[model samples]
Target: MCLLDKKAFVDFITTLWNIWNYRNNAIFRGKEEDARVIWERARKLNDDFRIHNFSIWSILPWAPKTCKWDVIKLNVDASMKANRTSLGIIARDLDGFVLSGKAIFINRVVNSESAELDAFLEGIWLAQSLNLDKVIFETNYACIINHFCKHKDDITIFGYHIKKARKMLDSCSKVDIKWVDRGCNKVDYSLCNWSLSNCYNLSVEMDYPSDIHNLVISNVI
Candidate 1:
């Protein structure tokens, strides 16, 4: 399912559902089942379901739009489970070209907000490492954005990290922190999930994980 669009994901699920229903009908109601026809029906149902349930806005691609010409955008996300937090980050230029991406695994337990803060710090460090002084950072966690907005650097154990991140931002020529919906940050979300699954802790420059390529294509298109 790598690089699957939303419609493709929905199609995959609906096909499975259709197969199940067809099997049940054949067993209980003596219906003749044809695989090809069933697949076509499933595809039609998926399209109809999307049309009926989703607005135009919802059907559009989930990736964020490109940033301003002179700005680079970084999307960061994290997945926490048990005693570990997996982080993902991707920096893209205004043309939606990936400058760098990272997948990280933090072997410690933390609350969701703290995990998000760590991911934010990772993004800042990444920007600094790349000498990218003008950046727009995005995340799905609104609370994380609000922490910086209110300067709440003394409320949690990770507060010190937040403060350091702020200092890094100060050194940047320009920086903007924004809260975006999960859908618009799918690349980083997928990277987080990948890191969690594989325990990866490395960064890629001028390259991307294969699974992210399709979604990246959709964004640039």
Candidate 2:
């Protein structure tokens, strides 16, 4: 527990639980479960248990309000330290259930705004990959969202990236980008910071294998 990192720690516990479960099933039910199936099931339960408090928060009166009915929101953030950049993307349904999330790490990228833009684009791609038709992409950094509202030439590298982001947004049929305050987006912000320090890259489908969820509990509480 003290030595292992977050992801490794979560996996260790989940695997233990699954092994105990497999033992009981074999003894009581005389069932022999496949090893691969057991491992997959353990992975699925990782995030479900990791940030179980989030589900509790989802029902809280103070939980961040859903912007529009039936439209999912993707909260994204990024952190840069030295030449390391990390991007975090997390999705929530209208009802506040955490739909999915990702933590990505990149090397040799030093700019903060560039990291922020990268995170925003990753959020968009994740939502699209999930086949979400209507998504409200959000970031806590106001400047990036505000910058997209204007028209600018691709004179510099940042400008070129901005143009690329604009084109990506334009291609989306029903995607909107907005700036939310950081307090409301603490979950992804925590994830981004954690990824920066640990260089952890992860993706969770609705729920699973998200070490960030564990990182999030410390923030919300």
Top candidate (TM-score): 1
TM-score of every model? 0.62, 0.59
Model 2: colliding residue pairs? none
Clashes of 2: 0
- Lowest lDDT sum, 10 consecutive residues, model 1, at 60-69
lDDT score of residue 100 within candidate 1 = 86
Q: Residue by residue across 97-198, what tens digits does model 2's lDDT show? A: 677888898877767777788888888787666666678988888767666665374366666776777676664457777888888788887777777778
> Residue 84, candidate 1: how far off, in angstroms?
3.0
Clashing pairs in 1: none
How displaced is residue 7 in candidate 1, in Å?
A: 62
lDDT per residue (tens digit) for residues 121-155 in model 1: 88988887776768999998987777677666477
Candidate 1's clash total is 0
